[model samples]
Target: MNTQEYMSRFKRFYWITLTALLVAASIRPGFADEALSRRDRQTGFLVVAEDRGFIGNEEIIDEFQLFAKTRNASLIFVTDERTGKYLRNSLDRLLKKGAERIVVIPLFISAAAPRYELVHQLLEREKLDVPVSYTRPYGESYFAVEDLADKFRTIPQPADTNLIVVGYGAVDSDSERKMQADWKRIAEKAAAGFGFASINILIGHDKKKKDDDAVARTEKLTRELADAVNGDGDGGRKTVVIPFHLGPKLDSMMSFDARLQQLLPPGTKFLADGGSEVRADANSATINLATWLQREANQSQPLAREDVGVVILSHGSDFNWNETMREAVQPLMKQYKIEFVFSMADQPTIERALRKLEQRGAKAAVIVRVFAMESSFRKPVERMIGLDIEGVAQDTADVHAGYGHSHGHGAAPSVPAPRIRTSLPIQTVGGLGASPLFAAALLERARTLSKNPARDTVILIAHGSGSDHQNELWTQALEDMAEQMRKSGGKEFHAIRVATWREDWPDKRAPWVDKIRAMVEDAKTEGGKAIVIPARTTGQGPEDKFLSGLEYDLGSGFAPHPMFVQWVDEQVRVGLARFADIRRTGMTTVEAKSHSPYPEKWLWW
Candidate 1:
């Protein structure tokens, strides 16, 4: 009853314990090399990055993986330019690996609605023989916009100040026509939140392709819009231009907000809506992006520190936004060991971020951007990082351009940086262009237009002009939207398919009216839709209204990223809140990446 029975019981308990350990090891990562290996072979998610191939996708994939890891989800990534074979192979691979529930999210923005039809067709065909679900691109996600708004809400507020949202506004085609129309609506609704007597919205335009010339155009546009806001007798109004761009380097280059000070109507007051290139506010867009991702992952525990980090990339700015960006990302610095670096603009860019992480101590890094599309951004980011992050680069940008040719990310030329070698692992996540949160922000912005009780033809515009080889492609792709709107049920709209005077519209020809008439006719013939959109990224100007105003019921407007506006507002508030946080927080938050010591290495200097 003592020794013999006790020995027998011990033997049975030991066997039971061993069995439990084996089962636990099978379900947990790092338990056995074979365990993770087995899961990789079985439950990996299949990602098809149908992009123009930008480096940003690599970072998005890395972040998505990290997010999955935090939630103990495993995935296998497949990156490829969009093609039928690629999609078929990817689906086949996932199906063969026993994928039970697959969610296919296209990285392109314009493809959002069209891709749904494609997915439906494929699913009907039963080509993959698996349950595959397709999400409406990245930026379409509501959380994307909400997170951006939340981040903006965190910025400090100014006392008794008026804010004007500014961004690249000019449209050759119509990718963001709906978004522009939507943002105007959002602006009108914000009065209840901001408590301003009346808030005005403006978009900046690039009169030409050259950066300096574009700057001039932005200045002129700002002055004109300012006049529309508060100026009396054409002197123009005094207002703050809040940039709504994703990357500081690029934003500062063409964004009206950055050039507003230089472009202000002579003698009119213009204040920095937020911080500089190295301030937390500068990187608020990325912060909002990450917040959206964390939610997407739906983690049970807090997000893994490895899952988030500062991804400093430029859209190739001539004036570096690195220092200002560093400052903007400071809030996360103390918590995350810098993990990644690269630029959409400059060279010594993302490469430096990765090397910096290796120099410090990081197993891997996640890369992301606050932008909305992923055409050119993917290749550069991938070249800087690599395809090892589950090989499934994710991004917020929308991927498919309805008829092909998409708008790729851009920046100034890159400058090379030092490299480091370490055993620590690294991976890349891509752009956050179409993240659901960003889409929600667009919707919020759309609400702003609803405030116009007069029921005018809301024309949303952007400032777009570029000398780069890609500009023409973007212009053609962007400006032709009457057909798309007609397809979507919009009619009687007066939209101008023009680039900035700086980019391509300098001729000032009267034939442009013929173009306007063509679009109206197309809209009527196709869908009986009537509203016209100038869908530029910047602001509205005489040039923007050029031929359209003479037509029927044309009203001009701009669609700056609503969250960006909110972020600027928040930055102002944060700077003013508890002066201690302001002073102690440091004037700039940029941290030197271990791989690159120069502040401007990742941006144009």
Candidate 2:
């Protein structure tokens, strides 16, 4: 190669490398810069970050820019490096683009990272002050943990794997403790999603420290890895190491990979190199990091209790039935702000209700679902509200399309389905069907018709589901309610039986209705007055049609009862607590079996 040609190519490569290491870069207010032009109001995000030491992953970085654009926010990505001039310039440019204020987010995985104070030092140097707000670092984000778990799912059998999570540590002793606590939570969240047989969490520092504790930890981990590899039988269990470490240069990753090779067991799968290799701008290029930014922006304006609202999701019915639900819900509005959504988790209806709540200045919403079973229409509603992942990744390409998730190119402008777009932070609490409170309420209804407990056979019937599995769940719920009722006051009743009318499907309805009729006859023949109760949310249903000439007195359903309103009030409280936890911890999984209804909950899905 000629000297002139070689020198020219070297210069180009060097400048490209240097610019990528810029420590600080800015997307102007509302991305109004000519290159990313969009004239929109801005929320300010000063994402405190460090360099991600890998290459070839600009697609993730673009997602962040796309997020910034959609968020109508100004993002000034900062690294606590000697880039004060660059930092100042980005800030100045953002302000010049008309952002009213700046929110400085130390976007580290741990708040204890020593360089975080560098942001303050750099800011002090400029001294041209405007309103500056600070939210906590990205350490507490549950979505970031989810991102790790997303990687964990790649292993063939998560149930048999041992997980080792390496944390990027802080230098300060107290900071390190706090950082470790956060990392432990991160690991726990990941474990909640995938069943890792065992998990070990260790803080991985930029520079290795020479200390007894660090040495002991290393020895213990090394011994475990070795034991796993050398174990008998079907060989040792597989180990998966997830590192939270990052660095400014490519060499850092190479060293990390080498160290992992030594620390990991022989059969371990070390995926330091992946299909989506980090490139160009690795530090500010992750959906998790971007979500952290979005979370910070949301938390910037915490809602007052009065500013938050409530949503009651119920299965809708005809005029009189619907009116009964509306009337029952009226008293709750006096104590709390509420919107009643009467639909079987219809997405468009939910979107309309959530937006209406947002328009009413509700920054947070407590959504309470009322259904015959917790599993009924719950997943679809949860998915709509971002509580669940859209699908099981079957037909992954198609699944990605639903969320506007693009590969190798860019993110789609908008998501088309399975999610509703709204600014309100929502936390849903429901499965009233599984509550002891509902059981007590049912008992109250039975009490009104019981002239003699010994001679009474209470028949609890519900408007049932079509799926045999769901019908089974419905049966269990009824049995649970019957048990609760027994414990409450109905113990002396001859028997409390449960049945479903299979109210909707014609193919199944006839047989179930016949079964319903036969149960009344059995009660009558047993010399007990049959007290048939519609365990519904409103007025008594088609029991009159089926029970026709059979002599059976019907008890009122759950509506208009003081306990029904009490259940709503109690759920509001739970919803509020969950919302607080989500906002405080930034967990995206919502309630993951956190409030699971029945252990056999899997049958509903």
Candidate 3:
């Protein structure tokens, strides 16, 4: 169809869709009156996502309508490809429906996209009586990475898995490059936690797929993929393919399995992310997007500070563990209502905390997970809070078609996962592995045992994950913290090293213990005393059991340190600010000034 003809049909369809939405919505007994009343007090919201070709899933459409009604905002959703023709009408519709002011959400991966500019220009040129605000795109947000990670979690074994992500790129070379860069950013962050043996990203281009070059391009891609899975030393590793395109139609268009079947190993499989004719991220049709919308909708309507609460989620074992966590976070009670839950994202425990916060009249909550890395316990916690989802529905179809797996090589979860419901505006901050505070804590612990910087080798140790990929990540997190320490007066130490003892994984424990012993032996050759310090949350974790013959001083981990309190306090402030950020800039943290948890008389250690 011609541009004008296609637009005419689309506009008619758009009008019919909204009209049908209104008619269906009014049928709810008392919802219409209450919703219209709420919208009267809220700013209108316009969210534009990419043209994913399929935007008409009834279940998805109902979710969006309900999201709009709950926010009490005249919310409109459109695609980037249709905005030039559809946005003006949508804006007019919002105004007619009762919006005096509006917020435009261009939900692209990066603000560098040309659509980002067109949005501001269109808003300026088509100025209505109502005021409007423009915000940044998803652009490097943790939420976008979490979106992909949710899909990866279902795979059986991440550490031993080889990942191949197939993407449908922009037709233009320059646009394609930018798009690939953004995709790489999301891919890296999402995969960092998994420690996949290898990651291969393939972006397909129309120019290469043209009739003239199709055969050559097919041959080239075949060889390239063969080398990736076979000759590149990842041959034996289990490989999982992700079709990163908008929908299942693209999967058929690519004909991935038919073309590459000869190259794949027997156990190779595809992740089930395209259950929907259209994937959620293509059009930003996710509950994560809805939660973000809820946050923005509440921007102008500020809740009192007293109405906000903080929930500190941590790992606890026994009485000493839980009590130490409580003592560490006690100072936070002065500034905000606080509830500390020391469980591994336990549903019942988290629900009880939410209920307490609700009883305290909290309209919002900041969830802080206290672990070594951001990816730790992230999926389960997020799914419980209704912020992320798994691509479960498509698995059945993939397996039936013989391109999926029925079981995984990795160990299963110790407990069942159960989701909870809540209406509070919630923002969650991840672990403190990368935090300067954590690095400083490590330095302080080392200092307690270091008699002479030139003669001491400080070894930082932690209880690590059973998954090899996760264990590698734990080691990397400790290394990152060590780097931070080295920059901040840790240069005075003779040497600082990092290690992860895969404590829970009996099969993996002996090798890690041997490595620790070798490091200690290396330290002794230079007449250096090895100072082994626990990098754990609290207590000595199997350090003595493994290092019995070694001569090293073992200092308490972060348990008694004042900086631990500071880290929790910092997260609380950051979480609150992120929840209220209407612009989605990802720059939600400010320096902790007078509110620093450390008292002058207290030692940092």
Candidate No. with top lDDT: 2
- Report the candidate with higher lDDT, 1 versus 2: 2
For 1-605, candidate 1 gives per-residue lDDT tens digits of 34334334433443343343322211112222233343334433433332211222333444444434422232222211123444455556555545454554333222322332343344344544444433333333333233223323433342244555544433222523433443444343222244433344544432221233533444456566657555433223234444443211222332334345455555444434344323232333333333334332221112245433344343322233334444445555676665324333334555566567645644344454423233545544543332211123444322222212223334421222111221222333322232333333323333344333233333333333333334444444443433343334333233323332322344432344455555545644543343444342222334435544443333332224544433323332332232223122211111222342212211100
Clashes of each: 158, 3, 0
Residue 65 in model 1: lDDT? 49
Model 1 C-alpha lDDT versus the unseen true structure? 0.36
Residue 253 Cα positional deviation in candidate 3, in Å, after optimal superposition: 9.9
How does residue 473 of candidate 2 score in lDDT? 69
Task: Give the alpha carbon lDDT tens digit for every residue of 1-605 in model 2.
Answer: 44344334433443455466564354443453544333223434555555443241233345456557544454444444545766766676666655566666665665456565566656655655566555555554444555565556556676677766666545545756767776776667555645667777665544322232544444555675566444422335766666654433334333344454567755666644341223222332164555445545665644556766888888777777777888898987766668878876667877888778867757677778787566555556665665553112122111111111112125432212424545565667777678888888888878788888787899999876666766766777888888888988788898999998877677888998898898889888888888998888767888888889998889878878888898888888887776555444432211232352112211111
RMSD for each of the candidates: 28.8, 12.1, 14.0
Off by over 4 Å in 1: 1-62, 68-97, 105-131, 136-142, 150-159, 167-173, 184-192, 197-238, 245-282, 288-291, 297-605
Q: Estimate each model's TM-score.
A: 0.31, 0.55, 0.49
Q: Model 3: how far is 461 from its true place, Å?
A: 24
Pairwise TM-score winner, candidates 1 and 3: 3
Candidate 2, residue 530: the lDDT equals 88
Q: How close is candidate 2 to the true structure, as a TM-score?
A: 0.55
User: Candidate 2: which pairs clash?
Assistant: 55-278, 56-279, 57-279
